[model samples]
Target chain A: MPIVQFTPFSSLVQPAFWHALTDLKIDVLRLSDEAIPVHGSYSAGRSVKDRESGAEIALGCNLSVGGESFSKEDKAPAHSVSATGVFKNYNTIEEFKAADKTALFAQVSDEIWKSITVDRSTAQLSRFLLITFADLKKYKYYYWFAFPAFAAKPAWEIQGDWKGASDEFSDTFLSAIESAQLASPRAFFLVRPKAGSDEPELAPVEEYDTFFANVNPVERTIAFLDPSAAPGNPGWPLRNLLTYLAALHPATSHRVLCWRDAERPAGAPFKSRFGVVSQGAGTGEAASTEKPAAVGWEKNVQGKLGPRVADLAPMMDPTRLADQAV
Target chain B: MHAIQQQYWAVRDYLSPVLKESKFKEHGRITPEEFVAAGDFLAYKFPVWSWEKGDASKARDYLPADKQYLVTRGVPCLRRATALAYTDADEDAERLLSFGDLSATGNEADEWVETHAGRAASTLDSAANAGNIDEIPDVDESSADDVADQVGRMHIQGGVGSLGEIPDMDEIPDMEEEGLEAGDDEATAAPKAAAPSSGVIEASEVEVAKGNLLQVRTYDVMITYDKYYQTPRIWLIGYDENRTPLMPAQIFQDVSADHAFKTVTIEAFPHSTSLQAASVHPCKHASVMKKVIERMNQGVLEEQRKAFGAGAVSPSTGKDKQKKWLFRRTSGPGKDAPALPAGEDDVEGMRVDFYLVVFLKFIASIVPTIEVDSTTAF
Candidate 1:
């Protein structure tokens, strides 16, 4: 009998509820500190009553988007606005919106632009799981965002701590996990950020386009169930091997044992799973002659994990995974 | 019914004194009818010649319904046997006397006095006593007074093996010897010693509640534990549950003042529909006591018949046998009754831990709280 030990499910499972991202890879890259010139002042605008007309006026507006100033146009219109003096004052949308404007139309235009451009970088990952520093030190496990199972829209593009290096929005994912309505708990994958020898590449402030297209295929290992992410849609595609395993009789005799601590080889891996291999010089019973039933629900060698490896095989299948999701 | 009743009463009256003194009947619930019924039931349950054919089924079918009801009622009895065996006064005197070894001392003195008295009475035995070798010992009344005085002294000191060793016997002083010679000795006469009182059960209202097929009511009686608690007390309590109270007017009896009176309350729920009645004892002690009483009743039955007759039979004994057999043989009770049909090859028995299931189901309800006494300044 394999000794099957388990960490208290309460501790392990409860943390999993909040820390789904523990297994996913997410990077919250911050914009670099280089100077970028923008032509217009950024602004927030709300409609107010015109003092003379008594009609609603979208007032106090400037530029909406912020970026570096391009070369000046040679031919200027009769009445052109010069934001040069106000560059420092209107670097952000809020600063620009506070500026007095000649026409209500300026504020209205700023409001429309502000509503249109969503900050995709800071957009919340569908689900995130947090991990304690202890867990990081104990298990050198990595998390990566991928749609390995599904190839249409992706569920998550990044994982790990999404908080910028400064830990600006640490509570963002935590609150989402608590309040968001989720289908399956396994909807998100979390991974650690890979450190490189090269110093980080810092880019000057500029308008950022969707960077998902720039993502490498190597990163798409774990499948995400959510469809909104591009390429992966509907649900994850099932792996043939997992499907084949699921097709076998529930009490299949074939044993595929998984080992912990891959470092030192202990007992016969397949032998333990197969129930045929014996330990030592003819001392213990051989697995083959015994004709044991499937090891799906059997104990591990040192014995303590739950729901035998074989039992989990069926669950590994994408089809079954979706079906069994809570 | 009257013959059965008469047989029952005859057995009840004969065994009542004994049954009333039993540990099971301490609360005095065992009525004469019920006690007789118990005996009647046992006789039928395990009949003498039925051993060869004895099986659980036959045993279950043997008991008469009425007897089963009565016996089941007296479920919880007194704590100990000696409580019922000896009355309060007797037990106290016995305790005080035991401390002093009066049985040994007093008996020796009694024998001595009896011999002397006999000899004195036989003085008129004449010729044989007057014979030469058999010359009469000197009959000085004062010398007799010395022996009497010594006996009296011994009784006062609580010494063993002497008449004076008795606790109260010394109070009699001495009227032996000189007093017998003078014939005017009224002063030292022994005071009238009182007899140990018997238990007198009082009549009380017996409430019976019928629910669907069953009738149950709670019966309460003051338990006196002066003498010795035992099976008869429990049996009597069981008997009271089934029928009307035998004596309802005055329930308390001074078996002994050493025994404090505590009222015992037990509920008896009997099913008129169930030819097989079942009773619930408050504790396992009472249940075991009931079983023991039933077994003892079965053992002494033949002797009991000579001494007390059919009424000495235990009511539950017959019913238990019948219920067991009935359940075993025909899958229990009515033919149409819902039951797991037994197959011809099913010898091992249709298995279900029914009792365990019932126990598990209700275990949550009466889950006992560990009562930690917080009163002590800990």
Candidate 2:
């Protein structure tokens, strides 16, 4: 048994999402405001097993974005973070090329190619993080665009002298990501992530009789058809449709309903990084350190308090719309 | 709930007519003429035998209790009148009654009617529904004299037509005379006519021809295993146009290796047409059931895999996966194809392919459930 809280891709008015969350024992983090789009949510138990050994695979990865929106004049900057890499089945670049459907394969045996590496864990870990969004639109952007771009980038291809690197990611990998295709008022899932893992394993469960059991297919199928709402109100209907998916899936705990208020703190790092912070001194103690930081004036600062650069990484589409026209 | 109930009633009503017109129409008719044609263009192609032979006691045993009661109590004279009408086709009744086939159970016939009615609402079946009955083959006066006579009496008895004096019996051909006429293809001369006093030329006969035309016969048969308590006993009554009784019929044959059930055919009366001849049921094995279950599981698994951020396994199932793979691979040579530039170092594409195959195979192993076949041939 695991806990999952479903967040809509847009709004959280859907009773289905709340019902699903309550059943899963995951506190519903209502994405009530207009900011975050609520898509769908669910949590369940899952085991990532090694292909050869049939044993659980231990893996870790972080998801991040590189671009942000600006008002009048702001320069877009490139960003990157470096981390240590472990080659589990370390093989020469040649061995990788001949292997069909392998997680990693060699393209060439040159010095520049030696620096490049591709692994299933790298892409998969990133995907596990993106499905946590409650909004379908956001989830769509992550799956349809961002994940493909990451997969398309050549696994850190290196040029002469190991300086210039070509981005080689495959769009095919994004096809593997799943969507919470349920839209109902009373549905929930048990999300149990593997031990020592941040991601919750998701398993969808619907209430039928007093017994907690797997839902009959009729109800489950309806949820998948429209995961936001149960075809009542057309406005933000996706929220209601996705509510049915809160049960029995992986990454169920990641579901968050948008909770936006005029005075509420921003949820993501990107929101605060780009938005101006207020110094209202509501708690007096923090004010004692600064010369009483400006309070209401901070709201006027443009682009700093809203969605920031890192949040967009999972949703970035480098191909400008105007470029497509050409 | 009301709509469902209404649908059920409609099914019941439609079935009643199909069973009557198709299975029991020729029951009490005197003519050896084909009752209902399978196709209008093929009119003489398929003959429909009647189910009744006109004897009250015999017809009583073949009809269901309720129907017998209706004929006896609701319209008392119908049984005897129909019996007289069936005199010309008594042999047909005897032939139809002998080939007993249990597969032709009235209940199954009713169910077929119900299923057909239920499917009639679908857009695909609307054409078939509209084409029914406004389109039945016509029966002329010359082809249906006995049926015409029987129905005429019935209408008059029910007070449905103007009452008139019964015509003379000598004028109309009796069973013996009709049998002589049936054997003689070429007539030497016109037979002498009798005065219209033997119930042969009643105005009721005209009304029966113009309206109240009898098209089919229906028997309400109730087969019970219990034998005691004769009061309100179960009866299987057969009837012709004039409510004549029909004899029981049965046929048995063997065919096919895989299908072990016997092919039992039974002829219906008057028209002397053979009905459906087939097995009642064919058993299935446990292995077949297991395969069906597996297919269902695979389908559900494939659906779940299509969710967002679902990176664990391939979401697609069945032919769609193959179609997609072929389409993507053949789009172009280098377009979107994963490739390494010349002079590149060790690129590990092999490992990626390995994991992808393992994941695909894992998902493909489970089978999805398919709908079961419930119909039995008869």
Candidate 3:
């Protein structure tokens, strides 16, 4: 899979960015049909299933802001933007039946537009890395897409290009070159109040009990709640919604580290551009070099160290796209 | 421990079965009346009624064969009379009767009244300590005559007035009759002679009106009324008009020895969380002094004596503080005998001698102990 470091447009009006994202050449992870894996510590294990189930069922994502972003902050820097996490189904079942995938692509695009337009949405794109194949048996698979903020319409149109704005670098390495909204997520859920006297108030959790309707605060993942598990038994619904919310307004983010490609931690067996040195003295050992041939500061330098860049190239092996990526 | 246990059992046998037949097992939500009544019962039953080192004395308990078991460690407290006895009169009698060999017992028998010297300083609940209980019987114990008749007899004996001039009034009312008249609206008043007008016509017998000197000084105002004789008993520690407390020596000297047996001095235990006084029993000398002056100003000492005549309404297991005996602001033979008057005071700061309330409660506790009154008491 070749990751193009794809940067989605700031405006959903950009036909170009969406065109490239919808392009079929490069393989991508289908988060819309997948599940995210989590490992954790505690659970109420009074039941046989509960006792057997090891590790708390934590539905998390690489895009989480360490669980803190789930809470709104009044003093967040203006440049610090959040992506709404939106999920979309990949239409795997249709593909199996040999169906045209344009409708599927269109659904994804529509959700992308919604994410850009919707305020405080749950359409984040970086949530894809949270998917875990091990969990496919539970909720099956799904995909996530992230869409950033855009200006209100009528008075202005999104330029589709964000310039002069400083990119937020919680990490300095791999920058978020682009982002996109997964418009119509197949699994996203919004907890709607049950009608009538026992009508639910519109909030994540009512009276502190996790209400499982179209939202699941516990699982931190959102999916259309099981229709059968309506007003009561909101556990599954709320958990899915919460997980999706967590993925979007992640409390922490997964950082891809791209080190300077130069520095290594100190104190090791010496490997020089010239020759390998064995059992080298700690630092002040360059003084013992029989070849008194070195530059300034060499008089004070210690071990034999080499500074040379290694050559690298992309391999031209031919592998199937599905096997390599999704 | 045995004395305390006995006190516990005495109350447990009564107030317990607090709500249901649960007793102490489940002292669930008690009505305020129960709270006041139970508070008093617990206080009296578990007084810090301890004695100093061998200054203590014991009474003969010839019941159980094992002498050790027969004799309890603590000194007798809250005796039926002024002088201490082996144990409470009823408890001692019950124990003695429980023996296989029925033994002889009397007020003078099982009792071991401290030698005059032993009780010399310890009789702190003397009249010198607090309220004027009955100093005079007003009438002889065996006399069945009402106050009017008693006065009539004295007049006839003196030959001062003629019988014809004495207007005939049937069913001569007792001394407490007017109080009852004042309480029950339907009860008609007996006719008084044309001479003895309605408005306090110089109550010929001024001594009856004196009603024995009353002084309720301390917060723990101990009021003990002789149930059998139906006379008020109080141990005062307040001042006379002279502002000087009854001198210690004057108490013993002024009272006759015979007067001692008829009076039982119900003492006060300091207020604890369980048992509290209406006015916190002031601890410091200055505070106690202030409380005394405050009590005098309220004329509670005067109020209590009047209430004594009004007769006790008895603390029912009711939440209304007004129903509790300790709830009087000013006392008289008011409705149902001072019932409404008792309601006038705020429960807080209103002086409540929990011990006194509990005592009356026990008098009416009459729940016939299982061992004692298995059937019924006549």
Candidate 4:
């Protein structure tokens, strides 16, 4: 019965992605500052428990971008959810700094909001923004990342204590969800128990209406690939998802499953969580009438609201290599 | 082995008659045929690793069109080699000292060596400095204030589903409205909550403390067949924590100190001309492979002896050993051995086919931190 805080996304840009960006900048967009579409992927969070305290540490969920990102390919590794994002590459550092970040954030949020309310697509819930100034001459890149999430009015609260998925659900039901996730990975999904059996049936978020047809509102279970490893906190993606769900069936209490799976060391048991969440009264009207404020700009290593810089001269510059070789 | 002795063996391997036997028992130097067989076995066993043809223009005619080299990308090198404790008494130091002789008799035949001389420390320092974002100038305050003022005036105006209209810049309010400062506070606060209360810490905390989840370096390791040396060569391309390509010196920090400047050198990879990677010199690969093959054959022979009685499989004769030492592929006609048991065939198959697996094991010692070899129980 505590306020549920979601873990923010930590941007992990692969070196190959930058290499691809460099290539793209040199060969394709010489002098132009275009907003390129890129793809980034995130999987279940890695649980890192503090040794001394034994309390779970809420580490940032990794939103990894790689060389294949530029192609906007949905080549997310198994068990990971891939989402499309916009990459705004500025020509100069001054331009990058002077750019209206607040406005940019709002624009992305508006698109996401429209997708939820108008397009009826929950896939856009994971859409993100990345702005960068590639100082190609110096091999230094200044960049900032934002995984926008609309704030919930009368913020969502946990209805009860969280329970492990394995403890709350049968093995058959968990495996069914696992199989569905593996079959076609999606960030958000809808799950409902079968008519005469304890096993659950899973469907993509787009089929929310049909999937939950004739079922009571309390029986509807909205699930997402939770990227937070912390005990109580969910991932940032769930915020927008709850907003979308609330818009459809406002002020209703719903069972939410934080679907977390370990894909490493093979056969690592699912460490997911099951809980109930509810929006405050009159949330439906507020959701439809007014767009909530959007917030989720990642902090730099210094924990400040600024862009991080990666000076790759030592790696990218041929002259630097030559100088080191001597 | 002494440098002169290694050089003599390397030269002799090139001049020696082609191995005619498939067992690969005598010397580590394997024929191209055996290399392909081993490569196939590697690909079959570990799907994460596969044979790549590389750039079409750079392909070699000798190897198969699709199997010119082996590659496993994005192998996470979680921590630097320096992060791990290494004492002078460790085996790594002894190995380095022993191989230190090879530095004198430079193998100019097939290997390229780049001497670090004394630049490693200074170069690494500068590379570390390059990563420090604090040195970069902050954004001008005046421009930031202007954006803040504009954000204050802006509000969500677009009606529901009105995505078509590209609203004027003034009309579209900046999105980072509410949670910007709160988000930073939450991120910074999360780590503090996990900090230990007591000064006495558990081993798990010590391990976790070593690596911040935020900083992780990755390497894409490639294995190419060195035709001239008749050995599998390893080339490494490393990336820093931010995914920027690591400089040669920065990469050197990840490599085992014993092998860094001694055996690893930066050169254009055989499969790609544009990218220069740090490759472990193949000058001594044949010698090392020969030693590994001999040890592996001995182990297999011991295992076979354990499974089947000593007399069941005839003990290899001196002539047979000499034959194996000289022409490994040519089977000795008089020394016919009994058939291997059902599961023992796997062990026999492994002798030649698992060359790369064994090669990877040996490479692990050189680059101890790069977790590329995922195979267990090999």
lDDT (Cα, 0-100) at A131 in candidate 1: 14
Error of 1 at B217 (Å): 24
- DockQ of every model listed? 0.00, 0.00, 0.00, 0.08
- Give the runs in model 2 whose Cα sits over 4 Å from its true position: A1-186, A190-192, A196-238, A241-326, B1-131, B134-378
DockQ of candidate model 1: 0.00
lDDT of 4 by residue, B1-378 (tens): 223443564477457554445535555666677788788866654544767766677787667898888876556554455433344434332311111211222221211121221111211222132211111112233254544453344232323233221112222123223434454333221533443432322112233332233234667788987756667899998765444466675676677644553466666566753556788977777778778677657655555544455433343533233212211211222233323433544344225666787788778777766766554211
Off by over 4 Å in 4: A47-60, A72-74, A77-79, A160-163, A193-200, A214-220, A249-251, A280-282, B1-79, B83-191, B195-247, B266-290, B297-347, B351-357, B373-378
| lDDT for B288 (candidate 1) | 42
Instruction: Give per-residue lDDT, candidate 4, residue B167.
Output: 14
Cα displacement (Å) at residue B81, model 3? 24
Task: Write candidate 2's Cα lDDT for B1-378 as tens digits.
Answer: 323543564365334321222111112111111111111111111111112222233233323432222111000111111112223434333311110122221111111111111111112111011111111122232244543443333221222122121112222121111111113111110011121231221111211222222112223221111111111111222322222222211000011111111111111111111111111110121133233334433433343334222532233544333222211111123244422211222111111111112211221111000000001010
* Chain A (candidate 2) TM-score to true chain A: 0.16
DockQ of 2: 0.00
lDDT of 1 by residue, B30-86 (tens): 333333333333223211101111112222122333322221111111111111222
Q: All candidates' lDDT scores?
A: 0.20, 0.18, 0.21, 0.62
Maximum-DockQ candidate = 4
TM-score of chain A of each: 0.14, 0.16, 0.18, 0.92
Give per-residue lDDT, candidate 4, residue A319.
62
Ranking by lDDT: 4, 3, 1, 2
> What TM-scores do the predictions have?
0.13, 0.13, 0.14, 0.68
Q: What digit string (tens of lDDT, one per residue) describes model 1 on residues A124-187?
A: 1111111111122222211111111101110111121111111311233222321221212222
lDDT of 2 by residue, A153-267 (tens): 0011111111000111111211111222111212223322234533333333332222223433212211111121111111111121122221112111122211111111112
Of the candidates numbered 3 and 4, which has the greater lDDT value? 4
Please state the i-RMS of candidate 4: 14.0
